[model samples]
Target chain A: MKPDSPFLDLETAPRVAVSIDGAPLELPEGANLAAALLAAGVTVFRHTPVSGAPRGPFCMMGACFDCLVDIDGFTRQACMIEVSQGLRIIRPRDLGADDVDA
Target chain B: MSTHDLIVIGAGPAGMATASKAADLGLTVAVLDEQPRAGGQVYRDVDRVAALRGDILGADYTQGATLTAGLHHQAIEHVPGATVWAIEDGFRVSYTRAGRGAQIAADRILLATGALERPMPLPGWTLPGVMTAGAGQILLKQSGVLAKSAALVGCGPLLYLIAAQMVRAGTPPVAMIETQTRSDLIEAARHVGGALRGWPYMLKGLKMLAEITRAKVPRYPGATEIRIEGTDTAEAVSFVHRGRAHRIACRTVFLHHGVVPNTQAARSLGVSHRWHAGQSCFAPRLDVWGQSDVTGVFIAGDGAGIGGAKAAELAGRLAALKVAEESGRLSTDERDRQAAPLRSAHARELAARPFLDRAYPPFAGALAPEDATVICRCEEVTAGDIRGHARLGCLGPNQAKAFSRAGMGPCQGRYCGLTVTSLLAAANGTSHDETGYYRIRPPLKPVTLGELATLEHSAPDTAE
Candidate 1:
């Protein structure tokens, strides 16, 4: 399925490649990470540790931290971060299983 | 810690205005914001949005360009991407920027943190495709993205505004389900005379409604019993309109009722707030000069109350003028002279608030969702669980939080505070204020222990 993106064609804008949970993706440089992820059909950002219910980005702004993810080794708000090249993003569950040294 | 003359939190309309006005008056000002840009929420990404997609955003957005330009004065220091963790007595602020911890003390502090969309907890709101209307607008503003099709639900001028903007962007929703009833119109009619004093706002709202109608978008007014249904994500919205049940097939559902002041920073600083009856939310109490009960602390803009961007700008200027007078930079007569026009402008800007408040007060029923609806997204606590706790004599939000872990999550009650307060009040048969809000403590936003360990203590006199 093609991702839903309303962004007008900005051909000159640079594109960057990144990996989300080991799945390779390409997004416009400087785009909000959460928006890019959503446009790539990645809906479920994480599941709650307690109830294990699925949740995704509710407030694209930083007020709701539903878009928490593991960027590199640190957990961060995906809505607040900008897309960058070669970024290794992992879901919360995957981050939990990986060694701290990863 | 380093000391400065003034420190402003948030870079939205209120904060940028305060910093610019104070700096222009010869007071050194520093602005700290979590976003990389200075244009707060309403005007988020104004520079880039204006440059890239100016027409689709309309004139209201372009107005932000002037404010963002004003932030460039030499006397105003802008510290973007700084997350303030705590505000101590003596106007001391500790924050983390780029993973480094630092502290700054100010002779005076101004908090203009702005507003958040009022929580509209409904059945199936926890589903994946259910999101706030404000969040959808932000996505369009920041990234030029829109869902293939969605249903817009809720009441307020913002709902109409976003729908009209979407129509202009050529991605109008499949339908708009507005919750305001006929009685709301009658109540608003009582305030029309007062609202007419702010003629521009009334006209702007009319224009938006006209545009939405002209676009031929299906609208369901007097909507109730609204529920979004889907197996794993929102697939459709079912609601009752004009005594008939209607279901619209759509993948996305956007919800909004209105906005409330973001009082976490003020509440954490021991600042006092009173329940604002007109807006149906708690706001920090302030004096004529915007000074709170705490000495050297002032709050202006929507964070103090839900004044729009224009009023926020004027309020910020007025507060800066008061700061100047207090600091002996301007005599009382000069200060009054400087403030005379701004006070009038501020009054003009606020004249339409009473009408809007009455016309689209949040649907009381929407505050308390169904038994199975999730109240806290982070902890997955349901409204049923909270009501049960309230039955067990949970008196207030803090006690309720202890029982259900509703407010004890990363977002820290930003999304669920208002809803939880309403649920407790209803269970106890009391007013919202009587139940009180969550007792917010610092670090305000999450900061890692590793970040705190990297603090570089500054000399006693310098400002960092």
Candidate 2:
């Protein structure tokens, strides 16, 4: 871990490599996916399907949908997911197959 | 189908307490929570993160261990990682759990879905690095994460608590840009005597402020015209403080304007809710026993209203006591006897609410921000668009939903319902109650089609 890591007393766990937006990064296994992504300097979680504006996890408690990311072909809340090995994540251009912005 | 005498949704303070108490009264209970752990947001992952979070988050968080521990009773089945999407007429709850779907039957239902942090819908809030105070707290609680030198903006008691927690974590915020004006404080003075009766709550706030002050964190009180100035990401926070334009150079901005009941599940249950002007949210209309207008349904904790965790615990137990009586295990007289102390204690906790609500009222600007600020995080609907809908005769939330798709996002208006209501009310020259809230439908949480196919019987009762 970097000495200037954003986490406090971030204990060493079995780190697993995950591909976020086609970039390989290591995250602490079983940690929050959203927080892990943020710690790894991946800030923009997704782009709004409407305007394509960049957005990240805002509520982290699953209330806001800002952290919606495609996890290995499925869309889910990153905040609600625990980090596991080899999870492929991406920001979906379309919120769903049939998408409309309010 | 798994059947229980009672089905409780959420594993927060309210749900856990209700399940444990009802089970002890000999009614089989099951608690379905979305998280893998039992502790709701307040005590989230307390068991795993205890050593890292206890000292920083303080005893209030550590206390969640006791509440979660109560879920261990044999009569109480705690189902963690369950996302309940629909509740049918026969007290049937359909939820997605562990990559599959399941249905449970119960004679009684309790919802303790807790509360959502009021969305701080200011300009650039949708930008990267701008998140809620609760969100930052969750990162710290769940994973010992902290964004360095972040600035917290908005008005609320939780902001101070979060700031103090960050200070204790050795990552104190760079500044606090509070939006509560002097007049707001003066307006709250009338409730001083009432709030003083709840001195412990008041004292805790003062102590937190002292902690932040000791750390020498710069605070801008009564700030106005606040804006997050960034093109693609949150680079800095600019606001008018003390009648002068000021900008704080910071990478991360945590915005909060207090909390409101997470009413999505309860509203989806088809219960009638009344608009609360003080909190500026809609709370379910429940009787003294926490029974909603719907006969077999009950609400407790913040889902019932915005009582803090302690009060939520007491209210949960009170609701459980009534449920116990209705389930035929306990008598009405016994229920009343047991509820006596809890009721008084619960009343004491809420006594401090009026002053706090008025003093640190939701930032007027953030609640109805500039035309450009995004109100609906999921749909990216701006305030100006919602106001325009009102100008085009969008009289209520449901109408605004049709006109602008303001509440149709997957999160389903949980973040934008209040703002949409407020904007329509303001534009149409009506009160919030008159403007009304979105008539929430089922599938409260998004359920995947893969999960839905696993259901053995009919389709979801929700209208497409």
Candidate 3:
């Protein structure tokens, strides 16, 4: 994977450990989950259910729900969620299969 | 429910201004915002981000510091991270803060929810690396990060603004693919005289353009037929420029047409809205003082229309002044005297808007993307799916949504509402206004049933 993110230096900000798909990674604490994941060279946040197309954060604000991922059993927008220690994040294989009734 | 003189939803420039001004006029005000901090999207985390990277983010962002500071007035109560789920009749607001549900009643309600980037659906727009230009700017503002090399696509002031900011942060884009044609520039020239009244804004845009040009960034103007080519993520962008086909290799592609008023909250409250052909979106109808047709309900800022921040601040203050006067807190004479100067300033600030709107109208092709292009990111609905549903007797956006599930995802229609409406209009052979938009219902945002069940007044009322 290419290093797309410019903020790779973790010394300027506080660092915390997080798991993406069960793989441990260190990200800046208080940074948005999408940014942290992108910085770690993790794109393709989730795959769509309809066509199995890959998607990532589009709006960055909460408006675009393309960055939805499983956080602790409940799906949440990665752009809206913040990074914290020992946070377990899972990228869904298929969004349609993981649909939970609201 | 605890009742107050006023309840302001959103803590952006408009909401902050309204709350502070209303509090100053002796009205008890409570401000609720979803973000952990005030300043909305434009001024997100201003206090901290400005202090850390003031030079990088620029003065336009640091200016938000003043509004965020004003929100700290002693007379005003601010609630951060509160998601307002519903607004009932009699100005009752239901919200959840930190997973706990609560309700508040107010004599007046002001919605300053702000604007959203216009949806620009295109080929491969759903790919991982394709995101909005505003999203790139938000990353820079909130986390001081940028992509190593990317192609900045689309048009409008925000495209240039983000490109220049990226250059300042030492991560200039590999290329800029601007979609505005020579004719658009000629169209904009007619309004130069009126736009000159807002010279500072014009100069700011010029400075950004100059900066990008000086950096020697490759810019392709009048580009068309843009297609992002990548299977899993955006690897390259191909477009036609100067009657020639060109492809730029890059990992990221930022798309932005312009911004539209975020009208979901207001619409859900049953406030009447009309299609704003100038900006090409639906805006809630409001009086000069920002009051809606619903009594005691007011709307301010870009949520009403794309008036920018300065205009939003003035409009916010004017709405608060009207609220104060209507509640008997201020004399009509005092209200008039205070609002006169702000009105003039607001007009001056908005003078260039007509030119900007005409110069960079929502990219026409973006509204009606190709058949295979995804229009709704949440449901993965394609433009073909929507048009197919329209042919099956879908009358408007709401009907199309029910048939295709384009606007039924967690986003609820924020991203796809405008595009769906336009697609329906085209398919039905009607104007966007006649095609209409989604019929919004609460909880406006996705709220858990557990959260609603925990409301302070969840028990049924036998008295009723």
Each candidate's DockQ: 0.51, 0.63, 0.57
* Poorest lDDT segment (10 consecutive residues) of candidate 3 chain A: A2-11
Q: Name the 10 consecutive residues with the lowest summed lDDT in model 2 chain B.
A: B455-464
User: Per-residue CA lDDT of candidate 3, range B1-464, in tens?
Assistant: 77889999999899999999999899999999988788888898898888887887799999999999888888788999888989988778989887788888888999999999898898888889888998998888887768877899888998999999888888889999988878988999899987899899899999999999999999998888999999888889999998999999998889988999999889998899999988899999889999999888899999999998889999999999999999999999999999999999999999999899888877767888999988888888989999999888988988888788899988898888999999988898998878988999998877887787778863355124
Where does candidate 1 stray beyond 4 Å? A1-12, A94-102, B459-464
Off by over 4 Å in 2: A1-9, A94-102, B457-464
lDDT of 1 by residue, A7-33 (tens): 233223577889888988887788888
CAPRI verdict (incorrect, acceptable, medium, high) for model 1: medium
Write down the TM-score of every candidate: 0.96, 0.96, 0.96
Q: How does chain B score by TM in each prediction? A: 0.97, 0.97, 0.97
Q: Residues A1-102, candidate 2, lDDT per residue (tens digit)? A: 343433444546789998877878888999889898888777777777687788888899877778889898888999989999999998766445354533
DockQ, Cα level, model 1: 0.51
